[model samples]
Target: MVNKLEVAWTLATVALIAGVAAYSTVLLYHLDALPAHPDEYVDVIGHQWFWEFCYPQNVSKVGCFNATYDPTTGATTGGHLWAAPGSVVQVNITAADVIHSFNIPGLGIRLDAIPGRVNSIAFTVPQVAAGTSFLIQCTEFCGTYHGTMRADLVVT
Candidate 1:
């Protein structure tokens, strides 16, 4: 005859694993779900040493801008990732050159930027004061200048 204690322990372990699996399944589904309507959409293109942001819905001319980082002054010129406070912003990310990882550590946002394939992620901007900025960095080892590849997410 088998031991009763062993059987009980085995059953308990199986039940615990099943519960964890179910919860993980549901969490993964929700994590990948995109918002039905986002307040703003920005196309993020990763390059060798800079980031390019494009707003397709701009009423004026095409809103494509490049962000160049200056290490000395700790400033970024040309453009930035702009969104309104408390608004839902979606970014379509891709790489124009090699693979890159777009990461905003403060917001816990990270996504791969692969060439020819667009990946999208949506996030709600924090209800902070206007002009507040979050640092955007490339986590992937893209090239020689990858360390300096940075941008800013500025609240409009």
Candidate 2:
């Protein structure tokens, strides 16, 4: 009887450990933990000298698409806009030269844009203030100018 009890205790302890580990794994990747609303668009563009942003646009239409800009002023054809609440925002990120990261702490969005590959991130902003904006920073070491790779994301 003592031996059987010892074996049962060992099995129970192993099961408990496995259950805890499985729970941790799920919590790590679960998107439901994100505090932002269920639907909000967010984007981050990394260039050599500047960072560009596309507000909460239709996710179905974003990806390696061509963008026109002012030749002299260096402005985008569409223009920079703010994210709105209750929208499914998809971010299409790519790099011109080196690797760069798009990070926004408020919305818990971050992704790396590789030189020859495109990466994407999707998140929804649950609620947004008219004038509230999040800060964007480079999470990769690009070059000397990497420190200035910052932009503002406004949630309107």
Candidate 3:
């Protein structure tokens, strides 16, 4: 009983609405899929110009070092934090100087490191993945050379 043009228009409108709804749903899902905690490390302190990594097993041994903007040419003197794939790693992050952020793009991990308190994040790496490398940058506006705050991370 309905005209062909009207039926086609109604169908087109329904399709458009469904498409938009689907797209928005996906966007929200991905946003929530982002990592909320740090990997297998804990008590990461971010100072004015350096970072101190503390191992869970050895609490007394605090490893202090500088982060490099360039991973390949940067200094490798400090100890590295390594995590295997399909593992849930928890990291307790804090800052001594200003607010900083721990971020790994490939691993989808990003969390803020605030002073006076510790921030925590948990992340699980995918299996047989190509391992991602990331650097920690000062998300907050700190002192001079704030842009240089960085580190390297390998997810295996």
Candidate 4:
């Protein structure tokens, strides 16, 4: 009976240790995955299959500009995403319709856009030329034109 009890205790202890290790690994991974303090906060609103970007000036200021990108010339006329190379840009995303995903393959980042909820992802702009462009697509299937939902990320 004593031998059987010792075996059971040993098994229980090992299981507990494994569980703690697994939990710590997950905690550390998330801590590293999240972003640091952001230099700018851009609000991205996802519609049925479209993406609308809004850039706010400051915390107290209500004035902001809407983003409109030019794919042909890789130029932004009105107000688009403009950031320096190697700058941290934190984007807060929301959805007006179904679920959509903001995936930037160049930056290796993807975040979900949920209705009535804002999800944020912070990433550093890579060192590239002023006219360099990247594609932003929706990874999630929202509606008919899920494949056509795309935009250009022009780094300045």
Q: lDDT score, residue 18, model 1?
A: 100
* lDDT tens per residue, model 3, 12-47: 999999999999999988755536545456567777
Best by TM-score: 1
lDDT of 4: 0.75
Task: Give me the overall lDDT of model 1.
Answer: 0.94
- Candidate 4 on 1-156: residue-level lDDT in tens? 379989999999999999999999999888556466777677888776557777675554244444444456654444345566777888888888899998888889788999999988788898898867777778999888777667666677
TM-score of 4: 0.70
> Sorted on lDDT, highest at the top, how do the candidates line up?
1, 4, 3, 2
Model 1 worst lDDT window (10 residues): 57-66
Deviation (Å) of 19 in candidate 4: 7.5
Scored by lDDT, model 2 comes in at: 0.64
Quickly count the clashes in candidate 1.
0
How far in Å is the alpha carbon of 149 misplaced in model 2? 0.6
For all candidates in order, the CA lDDT equals 0.94, 0.64, 0.65, 0.75
Candidate 3 lDDT trough over 10 residues, lowest sum: 59-68
List all candidate RMSDs to the true structure.
1.2, 6.3, 5.8, 4.5
TM-score for predicted model 1 compared with the true structure: 0.95
TM-score of each: 0.95, 0.65, 0.59, 0.70
- Model 1, residue 136: what's the lDDT? 98
The candidate with the higher TM-score, 3 or 4, is 4
Q: CA lDDT of 126 in candidate 4?
A: 89
